[model samples]
Structures are given as C-alpha cells and as structure tokens.
Target: MVLPLSKDVSGKGVNVDQGSLNIKEVIDLLNGDAWVRLVASGAEGTWSLRHLHAVIGSQPPAWPDHDWIYGDIALLRAKLSIDRLKDALVAEDCRRFSVGSIEVEVPEVGPQVGWRRRPSFEQHDRERLQKPTWDLRVSAAQTSQHQLNRSGYLVGRSCPSFPDLQYAFRAFFEGDFSLNGGMSLPSELMVIRVINDEGWIGPIHVTPTHIDVQVDGRDLLGASLELYSTDQRTTTDLNSPNTVTFELPGGLPDTNVWLWLKKDGRWLDYRALYRPWATPDQLEAAGVKIDLPVDPLSTIEALVSGGEGPQVEFKRSLPETKSKDRNPYKTIAAFATMEGGWIVFGVDRDELTVVGLEVDDINGERDRLANLIRARVNPTPPFEATPYVIDGKQIMVLRVDSGVSPPYGIAVDPDAKDRPEYFVRRGASTYPAWPADLREAVMSRQPPAGFPNGMGGLGGAFPG
Candidate 1:
C-alpha cells in the first residue's frame, strides 16, 4: 500500500529531521496491521518499508497471529528488531537501526504477524487499499523484481548523504546511467545575460568552447550584447552569427568549448552550461542578434581586419590552368600548408575581380576539384567544396577546417621526391613554416586520444 507521507502538515511544515509527536502517532497507526507499509522521508526522497513483526516490544496485541509467516526466517528476524524500537527516542532509534550502507528505523510496531518480504508499492495496489496498511501476500504476485533490485541499489548508494541524496537517487531512477560506462562527460545547462548601451538581453549557449557572454534583460529581442572568444580571430557577428551544428566527426572530446555574446562591437564571454559565469545584464546583452549580410568578401574583410571570427588568409590565384596540371593539386597543397583556408577561384588577390577559369563541366569540375584536395594534400585537410553564384558568375568556395597542426606540407608538383615544403598561417597571409614552429605544430597536431590510424591524421573520440 502507498502510504501518504507528510505534506505540509503544520504551519511550519513537517520537519523530517526534527523529532515530533505526530511522527510517533503515525508509527502507532501502523501497529494494528500485518505487514504494514509506511512512507517516510528517506535519504533519497520517500521510501516504502514493510513492517512484518507480530508484536512491538511486548505491546498489547492489536491483530491476530495468522497475519504473518510466508518466507525466510532471516527476513522475519530482521523485522522483529525493527518492531522493538518504534517508541524509542529519535537519537537512540537512529543509532541502533541506521547503519552500514542503508538507513532504516523502527519508529513503532503493530500487532500483525511478520512475513518474509512485502510486495513493492504499485498504482493498482494503491487504489484497492482503504488505508496505508495491506497484506503483503496478496500483492506479491504483481511486484516487479527488477524495479525492486534497482531500488535496493539506490537505497544502498544514498545512505550516507541522508536527505540530500535525492539528486543521485533520482538520476539513477530516471535511467540516466550514461555515467555508468565511465567515459561519458558530465554536463549541465546554463543561461547567459548581456547588457550594453543598446539594452539588456540573454542567449543560451550549449557546451561552448571559448567565449564570454551573458543575458541582457533590457533588450527583449536580444539586440544589445557583447561577445568574444579567447581565440582572438574567433568572433561572432552581432548581426550574423552562424548557427552551426556539426558532429566532431566522432564522439565529443574531453575539452570544453566556450561561446560569448557580442553587442555594439563589445564582447562578453560566458560559460553556457553549469553555473552562470556572467551577470544578468551581461547575459541579456549577449543573446541579441544584429542582422547583417554575410558574403565571402565581408568574411575576408572581417578576418583581415582582426575582428571576431575564424582565422583566415587569402592567397593570389595560381596562373596555371586545371588542364595544364592534370589537377591544380599544387594550389590545393598551398592552402593545406597554412592550417587550411578557403581558395576562392576566379578572384585574384593582387587585383580582386572575377578572372574566370575555363571549365569543361561544372559537375565534373567539382568532382575533380574535390578529388584533388582529398588525394594531393598531405594529411588531407577536412573541407567541403560548393559552388556559389555571385554577380551572375559561379565561384567555388572551399571551406576548410584544419587541424591545430602547423606547417601543412605541400608537394610543389605531384612528382616531387624530397620532403614537401611546409607552410603556416601568419596574419592575413601564408609563409614557409619556421623549423622550430613547424616541429611544435606537428607535435601538437596529435589528438589527445593518439595519432591517426592511417595517413597520420588524428582520430576523434567515440562513445564507448
């Protein structure tokens, strides 16, 4: 039977820790039944324990002896000890009964006979019972043993923390066993607020890496804000922040990502989850978005101007044609050399304009370009190639997200024999990798998990 525990029974509410006479009265009510069920505040929320003893410390018998006896003798003896201590003082009761990896107490005992074990509480059984007490044998057939076993484990695990054990017990009960495997990372959700001259606003950032942001209440639409990333080049446009959602190519890594809010050109970085690291005004200012156009030229200007965004560098287009090289593989190599960046075809760096390239077919050209990048570049860069129409002219935008490794090596020509030359990104340009810096970059390229399985590329972590 599901016994209702105290729910605001007094003006001050029932204190589980405070020894009260009402708690003694509730125990006395259980004394008249066979296998009485009592719902009491346990270390981990409410717990239901069955009383199976026939008598309580020689108290006057309230029920007949036929009410008990169905299971093991050890289980029966355990209940008898509980029955003897019902009227005992709270301190004495806790000392004698609460021990080991579980917290249990005998507040009072009824005149009912003790059984081996009582069936667990259930919804159907809850309806049939008139009061809190019920016969255990009648309900035994309906109880699920699996759930009981899990409950037993919870009881054992939460014994130490007492009342504060609710969080841990609830986590297990709700099937949040991801931590059981020992590899899953613990995470929490949080809100950021940002405040600025425009007003206050807030935005939610999920598991950000490096950014400071907060919510701003004054700006309900989330317009006034400040956002910044530790990685200087990695900034967000208050007007046009890309809502990016992509897998890490595997499972999540152990590292943390931070996201920040930017408003009116000011930045405030905030940790998105767990506890709020910024003020309410800061969070309000951070969540707001300022609408603006996003174009390749604008993107380049932002990167070159040392504004917030990914670190980027532009290069002068090579004079050679795709047919002349069988594959403009050298051009691909050039980009890979410097931590990977976009190679905008038909745009000259020395003179920015659409100096087009001859293509036999767009599809075939795209395929060949993709293949060259995949095959020619050493430690192949992770990238995507897509054709975008600008000014009624087609431009291939190669988006590359390079590894932290530096001195991306390039083979001058496909047939080059010696070690390929290495390059690195320096400001808005690419330069040959310095010997010391190249070594450091190469060493840092190795992922925490280990080196790549093949091609010396790093492998991402995966869920076990």
Candidate 2:
C-alpha cells in the first residue's frame, strides 16, 4: 500500500512552504530556471524553496554548492534579460563576440525550474531552443571591425594595412613594395654643389624624369632653384623639376656657376641645403661671384654718375598768384610752419625743375634774399641762405627752421583782407591746416610751463 505521501512539518505535501526554505536552498533554486521566470514576471513578491539533500547532509550545513551560489542569481538573470532587450532596441548596444555580433540573455523556463537548469536540456527541447538572433545588424555596421587590425587599436599588434592611400601610391611608383613610411613623387630634378659667397656649379644626373631633393625629409613644392650660367640664366620649377632644364650654354667650363634654391618665397643658399662644393675664394678665381654689393652708397654713386638722375630743368616764368609781388613773407611763414626745408630760388614749384638764376652776384643775391625773408616775414624764423652749385649753375637755397611757436600765421595775398590762409605739411605733401590741427600745432610748439602736474590743477580730478 502506498503510504500517505510524507508531509512537511508545515503540513504541506512535501511541496515545502516558501518560508520553510533556507536561504541556501532558496538561492540554489533561484540560480536555476525559476530565477529567469521571476525576473520576466517583474513581480514585487519573493519566493523560496527547500533543499532536502543539503538539510539532511552532515558537516553542519556549510552552505553546500558554494561554487555555484557565489552571486545574486535572480538579480543577475533580471539584469541579463534587461540588457538583452536594450541590445535588441538600441543600435549600438549589441555584443561583439569573436564569431559575430548578436544579442544574448538568460533563458526563460516554467515557474518551478531555475535558469541554471535550462542549458541541460537537448537542442530540440523547447527551453533549450533559446538562441542568439542577428538583431545586431545595425551594431555590426557601426562596429569598426576592419579598424581593429590597425596600429594602436590593439595592444602588442601591428597594422596590416597602411592608413594613407597617397603614401601607398607614391611608394608603388617609386618601386618600393613595402608601404610602411610615407612616400611621394620626386619634385626636384637637379642638385648643385657650391662654396662660400663665390658661386655654385655641378652636373646633376638623374634617371627618372625628376629626382627629389629632400631637406630634413620634407618635399619643397613651387620653389625655384636658380643657377647662373656664364652665358645664360637658368631657373627650374620645384613642382615640375623634370621638365625644366638648366644648361651652362657652352658646356660647363672650368668656371663655377652660382646656384641657390628658393622656397616659400624665400631664397635658401647651399649651406642651408647642406650641399658641399668649393670655397668663396675658389669660386671667385673661377669667375663666379654673388651679385649683391657690399656697399649700397657706392652703387648709388655709380648709378648717379652714370647719368641716371632725373633730367630736370627750371622754367623761366615765375608762379602767377593774385599777389602782385613774390609773397616772400608767406613763403617763409609756410616753410617755418612745417619742418625746416629748402626753398630753391629760380625753381618752378609745380614742375620741380631748376631754372638758372638771373642775378649780378650769386653770393650777394643769396644775401639779399635772406634779408628780404627776415624783414618781410612776421615772427622772424630761424633760417639761413646759401648758394648751392648744381650742374655748374649757382642757385639760392633758403633753409628755414620750423617755427618755435606754430600756427605761424600768413596773410594770404597780404593785400586781400579775408584771404588770410594757413598751411601745414602732413607728410611729404603739404595740406591746408584744419582749425583743430592748427590749434594742436600751436599747443605742441609751446613748452609745458605753468601747467599743473596732475588734474588737480584745473579740470576736476580726471573724469571717472
């Protein structure tokens, strides 16, 4: 006879009550399929299960199955399922395994079984049928799988592919099969060796259309490499050095040629390019030398003596103003009002050409002009007059100093009442002074006397 099924002490038919299960037994059960189901239910309640084997075992129940019960099974299952859902919904949240991209989660089972037991069933079993789906298509597209093999992407590995395509193409053209370092087409065709300040000369032989000359490993483009030939001028384009050719005209004689490279609109010498050749003395003996002069004044004197000065001539007629006589007073006043300058007599002011002076005695004429300026001009200007010889002709030069106090007034056409005008020099050209400029000039001319050291003297202590 089948004895009445044994009942637990709680009077439940061995289907133990939730509270009678020990913490260890409950955790064990939760680690199984039951945990996944509870996580899916999203319930606020708690449950328990009894482990008869552990309770009946000896050794004071040291929490048997410690290896399998190390973590919070129920919480782990819930978090795993939630992450799975997020991976399915979010484009970037999918897992990237060695095989491929896919979504993964804890398997679900009936309420009685635990998630740990789900993997035990065969592939055909309904519970074991749980498999990762390719819902990670978007993530697979977003993942940089190919980039993973690049340098620095992973620790202790080298990139199998080059990062820059231009470098690869250049390497191929240059007959370099290994695309490691950056490469490019040669831009410079000819190279010359020079010495000191004398000159430059050499024969540059290149196989390809162009042979690059790298300075510190950098390619110079659009630069000009200048070479001076005994009979002709030679220049090569930095970008297209192959097409541009520089020949010495009559087969490079024993004489040297001056060569230099220009890049970024700046000239670079042989020393800068680190090319070796002859010394300046050797080059000079070879009839090659730098074109620049050591002394600029000497050059200027040579040019002037060579009849290069402007061909200037003076007009016989004088300037016709409303005034009857020469306004010597106004002329002196205007000169004194600006920086001291020369006012050459017998010279046309507009044409700036000198006319021969018509006078009896050159020295006496200059003295007479100086006396006229001093007597007629108001507020006598500090000045001097002398006769200067230009092209074998005597001309009076009146050198007037700037006024000690400016706004040096001049009665323009002194005879006219309202025609009084004022003039000042801005730069090389003269301009009619505005009222403000006149006032500023007048103030600037005066010494800083009787003025207060600070604002406390007159105007209130500076405006805030």
Candidate 3:
C-alpha cells in the first residue's frame, strides 16, 4: 500500500494518461527487450521521464537506480501490448543518447500560430516597412525526448534545453533515485535519478508558445519564465538569428501579464526588461512628450509643438538653487502622487512660450533642482533631469514617475512659507489635492487623475 502512496493522484501530466501497468507487464518487459524510457541528463540525472514502451524511445539515462512500477490489474485496469512494445522501444531509445549526437533540425511539429506574426501584419511595403518581420525561429523543439518519457510540456514550464545546455544538477542538488518494493536493478536496466521541482517533473522544451530558458548559457537555480501579454505589435529584446525569444504584443492598453513557474512548490521569478516610455507616435497623438529616457535636444524637440495636458505640466523659472520652489517639489509630489508627468523649466507657463533662462552655472542649477526634491518632497518620486539647448534657449526637462508610495507631499517643511504641499495635476495647472482626491489617489493605485477625466475641479483649476 505504501509503494503507491507517494504517487500523487493530483499531479499534472502533459499528454500523459498515467494509465495502469500491471506487475505482469513489468516482468514480461524485463524478460523481453523492454526498458523504461526516462529523460536522461548525464550530469543532472533523470527527471520525471517515465514511459511504458508506448511511444518514442530515449537512452543512456545514466541512472544510479530505477525499479519497475505498475498498477496491479485488480486495482487498476491499465492496458499494455507485449507484441507492439518491442518495436516501439527499438524505435525510441538510442535516438542518439548523447547531446553530441543532436542534429539541428526543426521538429516534425511546426511552431504554433501565436509564435509567428500573422500574414496580415507583414505583407506590405508600408506594413513591412513599419514593422519588421518578428522572427519565430529562436524557439526550438525540445531536443530531449522528455515528452516521449511521458513528462508533459509547458504546464509548469520545465525549462527549454538551450543548444549549449550540457551541465546537470549535481548530487548536491535535491531528491533521490526512485525504487519500488523489493525490486532489484537488472544489469540490463540502467538506473537514473528524477529531476523535478515541487514534485512536478518537467522535461521542458523551448517553443515560441513557451518561455525561453537557459539565458546566455547558464541554469538559474530554479529559474522563472514570465510572459507579458500586450498588443501584438509590442517591442521585444534584440537578438541574433536562432537566439530564442518570446514577444509581448503591442497596441492593446498596457496590462499586467503574468506566466508563473513554480519551483520547489514556491513561486519566485522577477525581472524587468523593458522601459515603459510612450512611443513617439503615442506621445505625438496625445500632444505631450515627456522625455523619460532623458534624451538629447532632438527628442526634447517634440515638446515645443504640443500643448500641456494631464500627463504634461509646465513651470516658470526657479526662485533659487535649493530653494523650495527651485524644483517644484510640491507639484512634483503631486505628479508622483497622481499620474507621473513632466515639468519644463525655461518656458513661461502663463504665456505657454519658450522664454529662455539666464544660466551661469549649469551643474549648480542641476544640483539645486536635485537637492530641493531631496529636502522638500515626502517620499520623492523618481524623475529624470535632461538639459537641452533649444533654438539657443537653455531648457531643463524633468520626467517623473507615478510614485510607488502615494500621498507624497511637503513633509520636509510644514513651516516653509508659500510652499504648496499635497498638490495634483488638474489639466494644465497644479493645485492642492483635496481630501477626496487623496482618498482616490490611494484607492486607484496612484494613476494620474484628469482635471475633468483624471483630476478634479474646473477646467484649469485644482480642487482643494
């Protein structure tokens, strides 16, 4: 009873039926030319690769132990064919048992539809010119016969075996080789250890529909695979031909897309690859361009053409270096507290014109702006200071982020005179965020408010 007790009825299987195999079947296979198809790693040993001569074969298995396991006929009515079994074994195993034997070829199965860009998106000069063909060749079919071993694909994302993957989990890793009741290892049978995470034995393979693993040729200690779902046109990392990569779609509104990989029964895989800057087109359409990347004068040139809105704001010349008003900390706090935006210096807010600033010391001026935020703002939000000379006028562009911590304000000095703390963006103007606005900012995860749509109060006025 204890022999089968460890078998989890709830375990997930990829194309795995987990059907019954009787002791008679095992004995018959032992006498005949049958061997269990276990996915093998010469170094890491075998993972959850178990097969009953029903499918493709694999070899070496470099095992320390493997005892036959099967469900009794009285308890489980699993079917097995002795005659068809031998042919399948010979055909399956020794498909080049070593990684050195691997010949580069696309698997019989092709990449899935989502893996490749649709024909509609790529067939024209305009479309083709606008969007380069996203190559789907990076992801490859599982070089290891993990599937034939009866371990499933994806599901919990066993990782893909990259082309150069050669190392295995040392004996120092975890888990022991499995053996059933009173079973002796036959000299003809090879023993192997099962490699798995949190009881899920992953014989993972790389495919476009799946996440790529083994980056730059190293196995992460229980690495994670995440998939971001966006509009199909979204940008992905740059890579060479045959380098495996997946895509985060574009055009659709930004969303939080997640693909969780569980290792050791705990989920932990966090990494960020892209910076969320509005595309040039996105900025142009919205009539606002905040240089988050802190680009040079050419990129900053986009701001002169458009009027300010919720995402964009403006400020007049500073009162003094490190002075309370030098950096617009209160408004910066509001922008951080609400939706993130930009505040441009060397421009007249009242006239909406690029009136130049008289500059003697640029570094001193930059330090002043930096220090003001360091002093006045409560939980200062992240912002970039990009200096540009536009048409002979010196301009300072500061791009800000929606704060991770909400309720940013003038916590530095309640006694500071004329300091407008706890403010928010209301269209083209900045004003005090009211009790209601603060409540809403906390509730909405600090998304930028519209003056009418995001913030509150009249057209250009900030609500108390």
RMSD of each: 19.9, 33.5, 20.1
* Model 2 poorest 10 in a row by lDDT: 49-58
Candidate 3 Cα errors over 4 Å, as ranges: 1-295, 321-327, 350-353, 411-420, 446-464
Residue-level lDDT tens digits of model 2 in 189-214: 10100011111122232222222222
What does candidate 1's lDDT look like per residue over 186-271, in tens digits? 11110000011222223443332322333332222433332222322243334433243322232222333344343333222233
Q: How many residue pairs clash in each candidate?
A: 70, 12, 22
Where is model 2 more than 4 Å wrong at Cα? 1-331, 348-353, 412-421, 426-431, 443-464
Q: lDDT (0-100) at residue 240 of candidate 2?
A: 31
- How would the candidate models be sorted by TM-score, starting from the highest? 3, 1, 2
User: Against the true structure, what is each candidate's TM-score?
Assistant: 0.34, 0.26, 0.36
- Top TM-score prediction, candidate number: 3
Candidate 1 Cα lDDT to native: 0.35
lDDT of 3 by residue, 1-464 (tens): 00121243214422222332232322232221222232222222322221111111112123223221121100001122333332222323332221122111112211221111111112121111111111111111243433222222111123322111111111101122222212211212112111111211111122224334222211224433444455432222222112234432332224433333323343322222222653444423322222232335544455545667776666667547434342466678877887676778888766677886788876577777776666677676676666667788887777766777787887535456344458777777777789998888778753335543332322222111
Model 1 CA deviation exceeding 4 Å by range = 1-311, 315-340, 344-362, 374-376, 379-381, 389-393, 401-408, 417-419, 446-464
- The whole-model lDDT of each prediction reads 0.35, 0.34, 0.39
Give the TM-score (vs. native) of candidate 3.
Answer: 0.36
Model 3: residue 31 alpha-carbon error in angstroms: 24
